[model samples]
Target: MSTTIEVEQATGPDLTHRLRDAIQNAEFAPHQRLIEADLSERFGASRASVRTALLNLAGEGLVERLPNRGARVRAITVGEAIEIVEVRLGLESLVARKAAENLTTKDAAVLRELRGRIESAANEGSLVEYSRVNQELDERIREIGAHATATQLLERLRAQSARHQFRLAFVPGRAATSAPEHVAIIDAILARDADAAEEATRRHLAGIIAMLRAMD
Candidate 1:
């Protein structure tokens, strides 16, 4: 039985976004076929819209198109995931620096609150909660940075590497180790120190690369 999403309207772009979210969230397992008819019924979108959405996600490296077969979720290997993170290390560092440079009083307050929640989740050893809040903090930083191009690239890279990240989150002591790194990022941003923010971002992503290599 296919699941149905409770969306009022599913335009092509909306369907693509929903599909991307589903893939990233593991609702659709890696390499699971995305049947157009199933997706159309589930999202309340037309078959044509589903095709367009699939094509769009394929372009984002989230979906694969197989000749003589339908589309399926793209399975990113550990090596590819490391490469993606290496790319992210540079882009995210830039974003972090920009975020620090553009930090406002309101942004500082928001980041501090998120930092507290991240620490709490880490202390409680809630992997799911920690991952959720960590993503939120990243998104907030991207917004504050106001770099649309980097943000778009990072979004695609993140989605492609989500599965590997999800696995890493379950590694023993991973969350606790990453918690301080996240705090450092928030601290640098709060201090409006662009250099520190960039360095902290690089450190965080470099840690991810190291973890991925260990898994490999």
Candidate 2:
């Protein structure tokens, strides 16, 4: 049996999340019109609420407004995907290094718990769970760093390039490979080895590029 989400009960975050999935998961094909009336009916929201969510997605670059076509899911290009990954490598390496210097015992424990969940999700091959858990793991690393500027930038990048990130995650070997890379990052942080943490993070993202190239 398949599970279904009841979008009628959704608030802002819930609406935004569903729209994000719709765009990133390709539920609404690229260049497909997201007419307010249609989406309001489909997602069971008022036009105002749906407009708020679509505007939010527009700010993220996930949706674009046409001169007369209203809005549509934007097509992500390969060049944009590579550029986003390049930026991620630099910022995430800094996150790992700063986390190594700043993580508390409590934070390390939480990281371990997240890693456990991530590994289990990956082993089960649940793409939805793996994506959510991996996002939390990265967010936790950013939290440990306490680098407000970096986190803010990452948040912006996340909105702009979520489609690319989703595509990258679906590549073969990515989930299985990322689980151990998370372990290595956590191990480096736990040991307070900033250099190793930074290197591990860079190499991990580098592996993503390798995987992307392999897919080509």
lDDT of 2 by residue, 141-187 (tens): 99999889888778757655666667777777778878888789988
Whole-model lDDT per candidate: 0.92, 0.81
**How does residue 162 of candidate 1 score in lDDT?**
88
Clashing pairs in 2: none
lDDT score, candidate 1, position 52: 88
Instruction: Point out where model 1 deviates above 4 Å.
Output: 1-10
lDDT (Cα, tens digit) per residue for candidate 1, span 33-148: 99999999998888878998999999999999999899999889999999999999999999999999999999999998999999999999988999999989999999999999
lDDT score, candidate 2: 0.81
* CA RMSD of each candidate after superposition: 4.3, 6.3
Model 1 alpha-carbon miss at residue 115, Å: 0.6
